[model samples]
Target: METGAVDEASIDSLTDFYLGCGVDGMTILGIMGEANKLTGEEARAVASRILKRVDGRVPVVVGVSSPGLDNLSSLARFAMDEGAAGVMVAPTPGPAVEDRVRGYFHQVCEALGPDVPICLQDYPQTTGVPISVETILTLTRDCPQIVMLKHEDAPGLRKVSAVRNRSGTSETPRLSILCGNGGLYLPQELARGADGAMTGFAYPEMLVEVVATHQAGDVERAEDVFDAYLPILRYEQQPGYGLAVRKAVLKHRGAIACAATRAPGPRLDATDEAELMRLIARTEDKVKELSHGS
Candidate 1:
């Protein structure tokens, strides 16, 4: 399927959603469960529903995180069949096992085919496994379809530079790096040469502005905007209160269904709600002031 000319309605809606909150792309967690535990048909069906909901608007990237290559391949194939813009292969959490991880990605590349691009998700904190630069270079060199890397490692710029430097003066750049820490370190990431950012936060428009302005040769303006957004970003990183904070901000802005999250996580209590509301109010005022200044 061609990535060119996505449906305008879908793009408009998705862009509006992101712009309203300040994010560029959204990552939809695939059917939540063990790979073998879920049937192949069931997994495909779940992926189809998400893609349909997204409606070919806004570059939908599906996650494929099964422990084994077989399951990851199945999900990656399903995502391609369902018309996902891209697929992110996240490493399964565990002790460091290089060969096993490399083998899994090799299988994924073979299964995904050269036509469908893949993004390697390097989230060591959550996955407990880190992909070395050597492995990343090998994958990109061997698999022409592997085009992007979602860098979630701390000091992510170092990783980004490593990938770029290794790729070197090849005719085609090895990979595109996208900052994955929401907007927490976007300015530094972009400065170090990230193509863009994929963050789950309240102000995607701000990110777009940051990228667009920087790309347009206005690094100063981009840095200024990023610094301005620090207050909200800091709030979202608070211990024991990240997603709740995001959901609360979304609800307060009338964007989502509810502040409801999956179980085992506590809901925002009265104090949390009150604090979030206060932050929102201050943020809105800041936005107004910035708008007028601009």
Candidate 2:
């Protein structure tokens, strides 16, 4: 940000870079995009800017999660109005009992009305709201608006199986399962019947490649390619420090001008920076070798 303002040029360039990476769709205002830091107005404005730049080039899902339902509704409405493909809603944290979890989403569905498509953000590790497989099934079954699931629960392969098994054969429509948690277990998730990945990995090209290669019926080759990028991908998943590494890599790749993390965000130290450079170089070499072999 120049003088604490949203940098439209940087965002435009980043959006272009994201498209260049051959991503099927984009999800703005998610955890990796620092949606939580922005106020409701700022979030909507940024969403508008991103959507305008995207201009229907690819499907964009905006995260409209807020503590207040009113703020969430307004952002969702604003985003959809600005041409967002869908909106992602993460449940509020704390001991949100199963029924309340279901009820909260029910209220959200009612508030947003029927036109908007909803992607349930089920990152229990972050949201502190552990929605059971049954609750998720019920939500998808009962709520026709909730069309997608951002499945991020660790050891969630069974949950994916349950959703896929029930929803595919039952009267309910299909629920698109896009696995997250930094794409750490993507191969397994895909095997467990996830439709695709929806994580914010620094190297989305690798994520896209792995999913595409797997979808092409070449699982072994996909893992081989994923292994080439694992060092950098794993390095970029360091809990609180991941976003810093992501922006730093993007800056290094010339996709963004600044690696500066927004306020109250993590920045890499000199040691971290040096290690990231090494990983980038090594990943490039491995990818080149794989391409030659192929």
Candidate 3:
């Protein structure tokens, strides 16, 4: 959930909802989670609060990406002390070539030390710094701390295939690849070779089910389930505005106290809310139809 002046009761409510949905883990302070909009104290308080509530029920991963490695390491250390399973870092946006990117992360890994497992977030769309497949592979090869990849490159199916193929053929330590385009291409990502999804769709149960269903070897059934939620997924993929849509849906579902984001974040006007509700209604009916084997 987006951090704000929301009280403890609301935090507990949101945590309960996500727990009920059976998410393998929770990622706090992510891009969708509005990490940038939060004050440092607020971010730490939010992380510590969620960690306490979750209480080892599931692993909690924190996003510690920052402009300076010291800030990243500080946040990472605090999260680790707070019992985070890992911390995620994406390459900072700027004019960066592959070697420069690699060098930056190399410094990041060194600063974080080997004790902290890292999730290399590869969302080029947001960062505006594209990480080539080779760079990712090289990082995995060299950085023993990198334990997972949050792959969110659009038109990224081939990248998934390339990474997986390289993993199979090479001697590098294997990294778990989780796609993050709001689960839009979930079916195809799984087909191409994603281990699972780390994207935020309001209904995380959908992502959990899609991954489970696809991995069960029933691709057709998986696609059916995916197609049902595709509309809302697409609607929620609107760049800067999507977080509001997600928060609104969660609020509508009674999982949060307010759909309002921090100031400077997008607000859903009546028209936007109506359109979102309409898509949500259609998604519900479609999900029900699939469940009934129609």
Candidate 4:
């Protein structure tokens, strides 16, 4: 069955969450764990479900961060077959990082054919490695299907410079560079040249508003929104409390079923929970004031 960008069933729940909250795109983290560890067939099944649920109402991008080249290719192919708008591939660390990563992408591009767009997941902190700007340029030049770059580097200006520099090159193609720093330096990054952000915070509306306002050329308005949400962003960055805070805010706003995270992650303490609630209350007041005035 043919699927539209936003109408896929597997991601309908998330898509509904984002659309209702006013986000332009939806990014899903592929959990490769015991229960959810998906084979190629299983991945396709899940992707199919997501496509059906979303019903093409929004663009769905899946994370294809498997450990091996084969796994990455399979997942990318599965997502493409199931109608994902794009696939985000994380860099694999090794002596041959560039070669392996580039080769994996080449294989996936071949398997999925030329039309499937891929996003380079440049998450240096989590991946323990990084893809240089030269590498990005080479990949984009060689594979036209690789369209976006999800940059999660700290001091994100580096990534922005890389993209801008690449764009300045002769015969360079336009590629979307999305900030993935979870709102910490979003405004600055956007000002630098980021197209958008792909974060995991509960308040997608805040992000959507910030990015849209910035893109619309209202720098002052975007800064105001960023400043208003600064408190929540700061609180979420507290050590040993980030994800807990995210889940708390999500639950407070009635966005998710629970603040439950996979094991090995810490649970929020009373103090952390109280802080999260306070941040949410303050943000709510500011948002309400903005809405009334607007």
Candidate 5:
């Protein structure tokens, strides 16, 4: 959210909100942080400020995906030197062939080197490059530096299972598989062997609860929590307009100061606001009902 300027106070306030929500890590400048819109210096500054404010309370993952590998490596190094836990990278955007996608990640491993752990972001819908399960296994086997996978392939529940099965059977080191896609398929992904979620949803507590409940072996209760918030989750998953909606919800919940986006963003009209508030009200009631065991 922009308040005519980017200031430390707003950043700290946001950090406080997420920290309060009990996130294990914070990812900045990814698709949700408007990474593509930020200039290099601005991205670095935001990363530095958040790293400083967080003060080692939790791990911070910086998005270092860039069109040029040099730019990507530089940002990754900067973030690591500034004490970030690790960096996340996605395949370059294009209709890339599968072999080319595998080659790109091999280059990525060389660029990031072995010291810096990597989270391979397999967000096909956004990146237009799909990394198949076999390719992922090969990469992780070849490059032990790959420590995590941000799996967001649509209708990819079976893919999750396949990866986990391979990891269990193959001699390659296992990568932590975290689901994204606004957490829309989180329940199924988790059931299919995903480790957790890496989404930018405004209600992180719900994600935490769902993962925790499911992991606790109470699948029905996990779905109860997920179902309570699914309406708002779906409403906030609108492709081009999702970020604005997320910022608005965060502002409404007092996580940030404003819902303003930088340039080239959509504004919520009265009707949009009315629709969102209605969903919010319904979500609140549903959550309450679930909490009361109704």
Candidate 6:
């Protein structure tokens, strides 16, 4: 953000850029979007701008995660009014007990009402809430509104298998399993039955190609394609400094005009930039090599 405010024009440009990248949908105000940094009004404005710019070209899910249910529900309704396809809600960090965590989501669905389709975010690393497989199943059973799970739990391949195994059954209804954590475990997660990836990345086209290649019965080719970008992908997923790297790449690729994040965010030094550029060059070479060999 320039001058500590949301850049509406950048949001519009990025929305169009993502559409060109062949993304299936757009999710705004998510964890990677600095949702916590934006004030309520700023967040709503960003969502509205992106939704209007998209104009139903693809599904747009606005993240409405809030500590208070009233605020959460309020923004959710606003997004729905603005033509959002769905709303994403992550359980607030608190007691990690099963009943409390499960009950919290139940209340969330109730607050969201029946019409809003839910994409449950399960990022225990950020939310401090551990959700078991059974708890997730119970939630889907109890709340038909939860149609997607943003599975980001580390070592979550087993969890993906568990969820997909159940969802494939006759008794359990299906839920879209979109893997996140910046697509760090994407190759393995896809092998474990994940439906797709919904995470931040500099080269979203790489993600689209990976998912497409995997689904076309070319699993090994998918892994090879993913390996070409693994270095940059891993570099961009760094816990504290990742977003800065991501923005820099977006700017470098002409998606956004500037790499400047909001105030109080990271800025890359010369050494960091040199390393990032080297990785980008290497990834480009690797991708070219893979294409030639194919």
Best by TM-score: 6
For residues 155-218, what per-residue lDDT tens digits would candidate 4 score against the true structure? Answer: 6697787786677457778888887767788888888888888876667788999999998999
Location of the lowest summed lDDT over 10 successive residues in candidate 2: 1-10
Candidates 1 and 4, the one with greater lDDT? 4
Q: What do the candidate models score in CA lDDT, each in turn?
A: 0.71, 0.88, 0.88, 0.72, 0.87, 0.90
lDDT of 1 at 120: 88
Which segments of candidate 4 are over 4 A away from where they belong?
A: 1-14, 30-46, 96-104, 238-240, 292-294
Off by over 4 Å in 5: 1-4
Q: Write the per-residue lDDT of candidate 6 for residues 39-112, one digit (tens) a residue.
A: 99988898888899999999999999999999999999999999999999998888889999888989998888
- Against the true structure, candidate 5 reaches a TM-score of 0.96
The true-structure Cα RMSD of candidate 1 reads 6.3
On lDDT, who's better, 3 or 6?
6
Candidate 6 TM-score versus the reference: 0.98
For model 3, name the residue pairs that clash.
none
Name the weakest run of 10 consecutive residues (lDDT summed) in model 5.
Answer: 1-10
> Which of the predicted structures, 1 or 3, would earn the higher lDDT when compared with the native?
3
Candidate 5 lDDT by residue in tens digits, 1-294: 454456557788889898898888888878765778778998899899999989999999889999999999999999999999999999998766878888888898898888998999998888888888888998889888888999988878888999898885549787899888889988889999999988899999999889998999999989888989999999899988888899889889988888887788877889999999999999998898888985
Clashing pairs in 5: none
TM-score of each: 0.83, 0.97, 0.96, 0.84, 0.96, 0.98
What are the candidates' C-alpha RMSDs?
6.3, 1.2, 1.8, 5.3, 1.4, 1.0
Clashes of each: 7, 0, 0, 21, 0, 0
